[model samples]
Target: MADTFAAALDDFTRRDWQTLAPDAVDDPVRVAVVGLGWFAREWALPGIDRSAYTEAAVVCGVDPEVTAAVAAERDLVGVAPDELRSGAVAEEYDAVYVATPNATHLEYVEAAAEQGKAVLCEKPVEATLDRAERLVSACDDAGVPLMVGYRMQTDPAVRRLKESVADGALGDVVHVHATMSQTMLGELGTDHDQWRLDPDLSGGCALMDIGVYPLNTTRFVLEADPVAVFGTTRSEHAAFAGVDEHASYRLTFADGVEAMCSVSQTAQHASRLEVTGTEGRAVLDPAFYEREDREFALERGGSRVGVEFEQVHQPAEEFAYFGHQLLAEEPFYPDGEHALGDARALDAVYESAETGSVVRLDG
Candidate 1:
């Protein structure tokens, strides 16, 4: 936990946000959104409420449909929603959400940082180690927060898992095994391989895309950084072209406990995580992804350990919490700095994969 989080807890615990109207809070931040592609449609817009954290100042996109839809929905008064492009060079908005492809993350993020707006960048942060580092540095220099989309870290279930491990109920963290997968790859166009499928743009295939979850979650549950990594990769689908479709690897912590995991976009859709230690082990089904309706299990070796389940809090439900922190200026998520280190760890994973040798991260 960072000082900002500790301070936020101290400040927000006293506030009556619970009693305040669902729409009411302290001062609202002016929020701007960039890109209206998959994430904006499936998660973001629906996830954000107008009355919550920030008032929607402008919506930016290059696509006609996205612009038309966002404008029609928000009823943009001055600018056409479709007129906005990444970096949104044409117009300016207060806080920007960069939902562009993984490859484009750094450029747009730098723009938002330069524009002096809080940036909520979609995950992977960037395609390479240098890029993620530059984004973090720019945000730091600009005095802005660079938040990555590791939403599961805020989920109650995820919180409980981390707490349990922290309490030593899992004993000295020993070894961990986890997996995250989705549809192998999407077929976009005959000649049009989307940026995600392009190694130059996406940084990595499944490893950075869906693989980030396991990387983030394991670090959360273990409360440690992987000092070293050794791995192998494989690509089953043609979409991978030369990119690896599936990658499996092991991370060795300073304490000597290892995490052996597989990340794939080509296998059955499952987000499973298992942790083993001297005392017992805990398991979470579909661990990294938030599944509010389903239950997750905690266990000990051979024995059925009791696991308490709670309502998974959606970002929308929890976003107001962020607003309260902001109004108090206490810094909960406090912009996007929380996940910057995680992105760096992820970058190291790719470096190890590319070298086909055990790479030392922080050594």
Candidate 2:
């Protein structure tokens, strides 16, 4: 089964898959999507729809009409979100992709796990540490793989950065800095931006939305967990009443290395990651987004060298990797435990912000 799946995926890779529907391959991993929102519809579906190794067999969403329309457009079965929550739809697929809201991830993951389906959940795993831990436990108890959708982790440029750091090209990492911000709110109030301002749904503000990119990417590059965190947040605009408009946090790793990160919803569009070590420094500009051209640079010995990686389809790469792992029955990157680690760090960030003190993590 694995060999057949790999062969089909290889064939698809050789062709212009975006212009073609997913070929029906032998023993392809059937996937049920559990959200038809912006990311799910625009990014996730296209990836799965183009992959020969995975078949998007079903879709479920909050609105039946929207779900049905998407399913009809994609030529897949459509079901209500309630059917997925009830675990009735789990029998039709080998895995479920939970792209729902932050706070609703646990229930969907649990429902999929209960039916012994592999789960690909969106980042953070859950809004809170307790729920994140539970989500991991449920998947573990079900003996199924649980992967978090950290798309940047699969990007070629980001992977090269990870390799450089892991290979000790940058010796004795001392400090890391990352910033991700975007202008979400405008003079005219938008409904999409309003829901994100609600702490109950979004967990926090920009920290929960875009900040996790830096937080997770830093941990991935360093391969070290944070021991303590100090954070502060502010709501600069009256529109952001229930949640913060901007946040900055510093993480102290066990090796005495520190990472400073900032995230905002009312700032100019910027995303970058910089790592400085004893020997050299590495930088990735527009680090987290999917773009045709991305710049990565290395600085050493008073000289700077850089390279541009282009045509990176991160969503497709991520889903393809997940399908490969599922077929091989191997461990996947940024699994539930990995997401749990990030969730804990984020929890500490919130704690520190609220108390105005450094919060320590127990090893």
Candidate 3:
């Protein structure tokens, strides 16, 4: 047992969750990453490099020339999407990482599932609820494991917060407040034809893109899904004409826990998640962004305890978790069903925004 709250938090942050698995494979799981986007190259590759249980065996993408170039640069197998879909290089890897756009996730997932490859798909699963369900079904039908990439769930600070909530230290969560935003056009340098602005390709703009972190991470911490949602959206820029540039939503959990969340595509960099309970409150400043260092604090009665943890790579931890589970034959926490629940909540948010009324979700 820990003598102090800070020690307890430190222990939680340092303990390796992967070792808790009953068993592990003798070798690293080879992964064929299906997407040559900036995220796949910049973040995912680095994660694969650092993860103890995974390796980048192949690089695939929609664009053949770009994929080949990346693979050659990294000395990895270069495969086109069509080749992967046709199982021409199925023997090259044991799993597939789908980092494609929202609407195109199903195809890559289906191909991987058909080849009996475990899948690690990015958040929201797909562009719409229907497509998301199909992606889950495809993996289910193929008997291949599927995990959604919710990197925050694996963050040390977030994990410590979850432990605090579960141990009743927080005395039953009552409300959560979360916010995440970044300047989209500033990052892109131009927003003439951003795929994120396309409703069909990327789903809703700001809400579906970055808003998901707060909503999904809150659910992970609370271990409960929202029962209903009330949301509103705005589009002030011409680039955001087809989708929202700003979004705010309220989620009401069945256990009476309420969460207020907001996200934007045109704002100064900011990210935070604060949870309040009957006895105490916990806050994670600089929460949604992976690059920023995190600071966690807990307040109870009249005193507060602040803790700091060494910054760990969020994407690397996420990849290591996925590979660990796959190697151990252990079921993933945020599996297909978990993603489905998130998809339902995201759809409800958009629905409420459109109807100008609260939307109730099916239990």
Candidate 4:
């Protein structure tokens, strides 16, 4: 069997030539960035700022417009605009970033694993539990490192906040309220009928699209998973055939911490989350998309007092933060693993929507 990508670490570290050539470092992992659509052009590209990389590699994509544009703009050696869905991973590569729609996540991951390429897929992993599980099985069998792009988990402030909360700085976990919504009803009216809105592709409603963030964030902050979940999805425009454009949910954790979370594409609202505990509370307002800042609140006797401050790093900085973990073996990487956990939780949420009742995460 071929060695996993991470398996070369010890050998690279123990090389005797390192003493002679002090500048010698581990081999830089090369990756192919698939899906140059809206997300790749805007969000993921900015996060993976081209100038940060010192080595030479190619950027593979599907769209002609995107591949040419990306190649002209960035420092890529080779730009192969090929569809991953049509067997693009036939060539050898170290890693593949599956930036396509949520439905196609599992498909490309399977191909990457078959190619013995490590995968860094986008959020939710897949549209459904079965597909996600298939991806997990494929990667596990191949011994390839599988990571999901819940990039917020890589943020320094977010990680610290999660740790602080986990340490019981807020006494015992109590309640969580989170919201992420936007008014895309105008532009997306004709285009929104695609994979994202289709239940077959999207798997469900807004809860799956963006609401999963608060669900993941809530689980992380509260240090618990839902033992039971109840959710209702609704939409005014009703673009989705059966799924709701807006969804609100109530989750009861095993520790008795209750959370109410909502997501929507029907209205515009700041993506934010607030967590309260016995000792104190914290609020991650503007928490979705590109988070600007976060606020912390401590229980002041009978009243609650809070402080608001800007986040220390830029939006794209999270990519470098994640890169460093894979590059230099940084200790205490909370994001990548937590992203996996969040993906699992998202699967549970979809299951809840399917059954229309409180669904246990394990069940």
Candidate 5:
């Protein structure tokens, strides 16, 4: 069994996986970041810098001048948006990180796949399930590896939490509660036209943005898919326009497991994930974020035990893991299929919220 599993990994790496670019394994993975927005600048760039196995070699954005300035500042080649749209920029790097607006994920992903470059796209894959499926199919058809940027999947503490639950340490997971909230809109000096506020561009508001963290984390911990979802969403602030400012949803899984999630754009910063089982409960506060340290706690027998992990950088770990999969020819976790599942779930959440009814998922 061990040898067979190893052989499967080898086959996945050699035959099923395409290198980020030709001869990519022989050198540092060269990445062209397709969006220079806040996430790319603050999180992705810093993480790439910290990764010993990857480098940010190029940048592309909607504004050529800003893109050039950012590229120059980072000492990278700046590809024009048109060049990228035309798929001409794919040859310049080993991988492409699509950090563009949610609506634009399909265009960039298709472009990267056509060029046979490995793709690391920011979360949600696409705002809608159909588009997300198309993105996954594009990569599969092109024979290139496609990874979604779910940083928490690479966090050691998060991994340990999932493992503990799976190993029966928590004793038959029965329930999970997760919350991820942030204050983005109605904040001082915020850009309302940044595409995040527009449903046409963002797909949805708070749920599509921060809600996916709780939703995805619940799935990750349980290692199961929800059979049905009921959701409620609200736009409390006028700034939300056509999108939601807050969303709360419940997921009913097989075997009687359930998950409740809340996400908001109007609330103060808060994030947490808690899992309850027959034996004990585990909680991870501030569940999703890239930081140097994280805390996790366990409750059992009228007592609580907690631990803090140090030197944890989720983005850096994510890039390193991707490199490891590419070099070792192994299947990478949190790949496009994983993202597609999350997308479908989120779509159900929105549908349930809109119709004020439970959305039953098809197997």
Candidate 6:
């Protein structure tokens, strides 16, 4: 049995994976990063700097002085959001990375599209489905590549899991269990006036913020969209009154795979994804958080085998993948259409929670 597991794992490693681009291009993709929030300041800018295929060329934000200061420190040009929206500095970068709030993605994306620059928009696409559709249409009409930042798709462990499931090493995946949670107020120093708590800004609460990880990652692993969802949500915290502080949703896929997922903003910080199949089960502990070390293991017939891989800076990996695909002139997966589906699924989950009934997608 151990030998059988080894062979299956060997097959998993043999599949082609995304890697550094060859020394083919002379220049890296110059990226203009909009939004100087914590993610952009901490992860996205540093990630772009680390990526061999990409570099940060400009910073744009609502506050011109703050944006310019950030750009000065990084030795990059800083421009007001208006300049980006109007394509005033379009010559400085080849692509744009939209890291702004959830509700304001379309304007930056459309601005980039009009300038014929590729866009890598952060997840959830936009705050609403109609806006998401318009965001996609903007890129579609411009005929430029639009990639959603589903960085897990580029993680080594996640890639291996996808391979295992796709190759039937899991023998018809039967069910999935996923959890992602974090103490939002604690993380923000007990600040209750943040945009995440506002439904208009964040689209929802815990479900929209962290729940998308499990939902989208499961869809990536199974290669199928959820056809239906049943959900329940709660908001006990005063800060979370406008949005859910806790949410649990069950997703039903077309292939009979059912995923039970839970997310929260006022819970302990942790993430886990588990998949069960007829032959064996695979688990990815610390799956969603990019900062932690990811551990992957497969168990069957009272035996378990662990797979090993080096942890990577996820944002860097994601940015490199986007740059490589852009330079190669290939279509990037998790494109606008993919994100739109997630937007729909997210809405369905919220609808189910409110209506106290299962919500059917695409109906």
Alpha-carbon RMSD, each predicted model: 5.6, 6.6, 2.1, 8.8, 6.1, 1.8
- Give the clashing pairs for model 3: none
Residue-by-residue lDDT tens digits, candidate 5, 1-363: 232122212221121233344344457788889988877888888888777668888899988888989988988889887787687756678888899999899999998888888999998889788899999999999999998988877776677777668766677888899998877855423667678888888999889988888888788878888899999999977779799889999999988898999988878877889999888788888787664256787776666766634646678778877765766667877899889888988999999998999998866
Cα RMSD for predicted model 5: 6.1
Better of 1 and 3 by lDDT: 3
Local distance difference test, candidate 2 = 0.81
Stretches of model 2 off by over 4 angstroms after superposition: 1-25, 186-194
Question: Which candidate, 5 or 6, has the higher lDDT?
Answer: 6
Predicted structure 3: lDDT: 0.88
TM-score of each: 0.82, 0.90, 0.95, 0.79, 0.90, 0.96
Evaluate all candidate structures by whole-model CA lDDT and list the values in order: 0.65, 0.81, 0.88, 0.62, 0.80, 0.88
Give lDDT tens digits, candidate 1, residues 1-363.
Answer: 222123222332132334445456555755566677665655566566633665555666757676767767876522433333334433445566677777777776776777677777777777777777788888889987656666666665566666667777667788999888766443222333567678887877878777777877787777787888877778866778767688887888899989888888767777788887787676777675543343455555555543444454455544454444445555544234446656666666667777877888775
Model 4 CA lDDT for position 68: 71
Give the C-alpha miss distance for residue 171 in model 5, angstroms: 1.2
Look at candidate 2 and give me any clashing residue pairs: none
What value does the lDDT take at residue 147 in candidate 5?
A: 89
Write model 3 residue lDDT over 1-363, tens digit each, in one string.
123355448665664566643234457899999988888888899999888888999999888889989899889999888898999988999999999889999999998999999999998799999999999999999999999999998889998888788877778799999999999878656556767888999998899899899999999999889999999999998988889999999999988889999999999889999999988888999898877888898888878888856788888989889988877678889999999998999999999999999999965
Q: Candidate 2: TM-score? A: 0.90
lDDT tens string, model 6, 126-233? 988999999999999999999999999887788888877887777889999999999988875658877888899889988888999999999999999999999999
lDDT of 6: 0.88
Predicted structure 4, TM vs. truth: 0.79
